[model samples]
Target: MTLEVHGMTEIQQLAGKDLGRSAWRTVSQELIDGFADVSGDHQWIHVDAQRAAAGPYSKTIAHGYMILSWGVPMFAELLTVSGVGRSLNYGVNTVRFPAPVPVGSRVRLHASVIDVQPVKNGGVQMVRGFTFEIEDCTKPACVAESITHFYP
Candidate 1:
């Protein structure tokens, strides 16, 4: 389910809230290849399926940044900020890929509003924690603390 909030006041009240999980999304080889093409990171483990078949994960794996880049879209499934002038991705404080996301795997996001602080100009700085959980995997594919500034 999506949590809807309007304006800075509503956003400020979200401190320490567990926003919930997003729906599963498949990690396809084509998608991985596309990302590699755009990012110029055609690592053998990421794009060479034939060579990757004999590699560590036994298949092509998605780049950590590819998974990180999904933070916005996947997080949109859990929360929506409306009635604001704009929302800006401030940055990520930390990010780690604890496990590889193999092609043909499914991943979902588990998000929490770790903190919300009032910033200058009637804006709110929100620290959102994200865990990209890979289906059937013991460790998460990615974990991060993404910060955003919402202005009214």
Candidate 2:
């Protein structure tokens, strides 16, 4: 769903609402490998399948950052603000890695708008709380609260 910002007041009113969950994405070895290559984090646990199979996690696991990267697109799917010319990612208020995301796992995002307030220059600062859940897992892989500034 697209978030249309009819007006500042309407956007502000979205605060305290739960945005819908995003589409499921499978975490594959290729994705993990690509992330490792770009980040230069070729840790054995994330790249070496055999070693990882014998390691504590029992399989290659996705990087924490890789999971974090999924948040943006997921948030976009959850909320679309209309009437806004631009939006800037302010920063994250908090982030926690609650559990590991194993390779081959399917993950999805669940988000909620926690707070909204007007900023200078006719912008609105929104705080969104996100939980990234691994399919069929009881614990979430990541939980974070991020802030963004929307220029209306």
Candidate 3:
């Protein structure tokens, strides 16, 4: 799903609604490598497939931040508002990595609108509560609640 906002006024109306789930995506080695390169975090567990095969997880896994990156896209699939000129990422209230997302695993996200409040300059601030689950896994890979500021 794609989120399109024409202005801030419309965004204010979606402050506290369920924004659906996103499509499942596979966690690939190439994605891990790219994230490692960009973040300078080439941890063996995330980049060394061979070595990681003998480690506790038994396979290279995605970085926690990489999984967290799906928050916006996943939430976008669930909810969209018209009339928003622009939006800004304000901050995150909480973030937790509950499980490792091994390479080749599929994952998806679930999101809900937690709060929406008016901000200065005719803007609105919205918060989303998110839970990310790995395909076929009982435990969620990540749980995060983030805030976004939308300007009219």
Error of 2 at 71 (Å): 0.8
Question: What value does the lDDT take at residue 2 in candidate 1?
Answer: 93
lDDT of 3 by residue, 1-152 (tens): 66565566666666667766789999999999999999999999999999999999999999999999988877777777666677898999999999999999999988877888999988888988889989999999999999998887
* Clash count (model 2, backbone only): 8
Looking at model 1, report the run of 10 residues with the lowest lDDT sum.
5-14
**Segments in model 3 whose C-alpha atoms lie over 4 Å from true places:** 1-9
* lDDT for position 146 in model 3: 92
What tens-digit string does per-residue lDDT give for candidate 1 at 53-140? 9999999999999999999999999999899998999999999999999999999999999999989998889999999999999999
Task: Give the residue spans of candidate 1 off by over 4 A.
Answer: none
Per-model lDDT: 0.95, 0.90, 0.87
Among the numbered candidates, top TM-score falls to 1
TM of each candidate vs. truth: 0.98, 0.94, 0.91
Compared with the true structure, model 2 gives a TM-score of 0.94
Q: Tens digit of lDDT per residue, candidate 2, span 1-152?
A: 64555767887998998887899999999999999999999999999999999998999999998999889988878777677788899999899999999999999999899999999999899999999999999999999998988886
Error of 2 at 95 (Å): 0.5
